[model samples]
Target: MSTVVIAPELQKFLEVVRAELSDLDAEEQREITDGLVADLTDLIDDQGIEALGDPVAYAAELRQAAGLVSARKQVRERVAVGIRVHAVLDAAKARCRHVLEGLPGDVDELLTSLQPAWWVVRAYIAVQSVLLSSGGWSLSPVPDDSISGALALLVVVAASVQLGRGRLWPLTRWSGSALLRVVVLAINLIAIGLVPAVAGGFENREWDNYDAGYSDGMNEATGAYAVDDAGGTLFASGLPVGNIYPYDAAGNPLVGIQLFDQHGNPIQVKGKNECVYEGPEEVLTDTSRVFFPWSDGAAQRWNVFPLPSRIQGADVAEPDPTAFTGTNRPAVSGFPFVAVPKVSLPGLLTSAATTPPKAFVPGARTEDVNLVESGC
Candidate 1:
């Protein structure tokens, strides 16, 4: 092997190559650098460094030839993949910088030239503030329906006003007189802070009232329940004065259904949706439906009521004393009924004309007797 003396400039060029090829493995980097040093040592002796062109650019070309990424490009690509969010932000910043750089002058001068567009943004922000205060408008950068929205408006107003006067800060405007600027700055801060607080306070008041109204309306719709066991608890077929429609295990309507009591006598629902003894003159209201103790014994109705209507307590049909077996015969004193005034009058008239009279008064056995007699 011949001894080769590498020149300082050639060594420096090889170092640059090493740096450019740093993304490659140590063994791969050494192989590329050693090959380049061996070949380029004689080239440098024959032709000066100038003939080889810029070292960095030459190193980049060499890196590409070796199927390796250059140091700067590799770093950028790695960062781009690793921090995708930052990459997007950097692209946006670069675009903005390019747009600003394309303008007639530098940053401050460009801002002054594009004053009209900035003012338009400021004006739009101000209009949004007015709408937000009135509870009519909301958008991003300022969270909707939040106290922070008011604060955001104040900040935008402050920045916009300063920008309109070709200044960044209120104090900087009166920079010639430090004391005067300080006083004005303090006063401006006070005004900005106070205005939003006061405005937002009023807006908050309106929203608070709206929320409270909805809450109170819900509370009023669900009336309280009351039970009076006057007749006794046990009955044969129909439920106590409150249960509107009775259903069996199979969900079949108990109306006109025959059921036998503990004594095994055939009990038939003759008419009026109540149970009558086959052999005797006694009438019965079914006591099987018990009040759920969990809801403070509150009565429940189906969600059949139309919305935007109030619910109120209404008087039910008076209880019959002779129907039940136990002394704890319960009566539903009040039923929470939907009071849609628009529908109630017409509904009541239709019900009165169509519904059987015995459905309204289950205690009346005269109709049941006539039905049983007719059937027999």
Candidate 2:
């Protein structure tokens, strides 16, 4: 390559300008200096040495013309800002350390010693991320009793621990890279985001164990599970009661009786139009017979006592879902008991009628036999 020679004065001026601009990034410096040697040679050949002027002022003018910052001023401003930030961070860190150290029972040391605990936490969470990403909302973070789950947890936890200890692949080789730091931060955020779901999953984990119309401790009769189990159900003799019967002191069936637990939660049930029955000591067979559940003017309320029953007939306002497609079956629902005998009235409720409020006292069965034998 042939060298283009320049006058000593012009060469000296370019060198001085380059030196003044040393603090700018390489690309910015190259933008100002790329063709300068040849351009400066031509300029000096035309306008004698007087056009060169002071090199520092020339560098500043070139930077301004190119829309770049004045390098010396930028360096000074950055260094001053860095010093302030550094001092603030150091003071804050020291204050935190002092406050922690002053707390009861070596709090600072305890936190430092708990680094491995964080490793365990993040390890569980990292494994949790895979499950969450794969379409599980309510699930155990560390799934138990399964080889796939246990092995995944073991592998992730070991990797997470090694990463925290700076011994894993990316940690050992590329810890200083900004992209790697961002990836690590994103992984941490995802893990934190799944924390609530993991907790909720455990709280309602019985649903996960449900199978074939049976849940934990469920009997074949009255065996069913609901999400947020107790919230939407009533229990009698420790099993789920699908519906309740409420009879008045006169043995009259009551409908639309809003019931609640002691906690004041509205008792509700799932399933749109669940099959239910009535009549004491009757064979509880499901039929096309309908029950008109109460509506708070919005949706059907199944918890209302004595869900009124009738046969499918010509008067139902809505179509039957079980009917053939595009045709509404004639389904009718009505109050099953509009009237009954009164206990307080003369001859209305005889002693032969069922006892009022329908609860048997202790040994009432034996007493009933005794009364029948005595012919009272």
TM-score per candidate: 0.29, 0.42
Predictions in order: lDDT: 0.45, 0.60
Best by TM-score: 2
lDDT of 1 by residue, 240-277 (tens): 23123333333222232223558964322211122333
Going through the candidates in the order shown, the clash numbers are 5, 0
- Backbone clash total for model 1 is 5
Model 2: per-residue lDDT, tens digit, 1-376?
9877778898789889998888788999999898988887777789878988899898888888888876568768866876675566568769999999878998888888997888788888666656656776556535644788989888888998887676787567765444455566676677788778676666556566564236545633444443344446544444444345554666555534677768986666431232223443342233323434566878767666644433333233233445434344322223234445655765564333442332211111111111010111
Model 2 ranges off by over 4 Å = 1-8, 18-57, 63-92, 173-193, 206-376
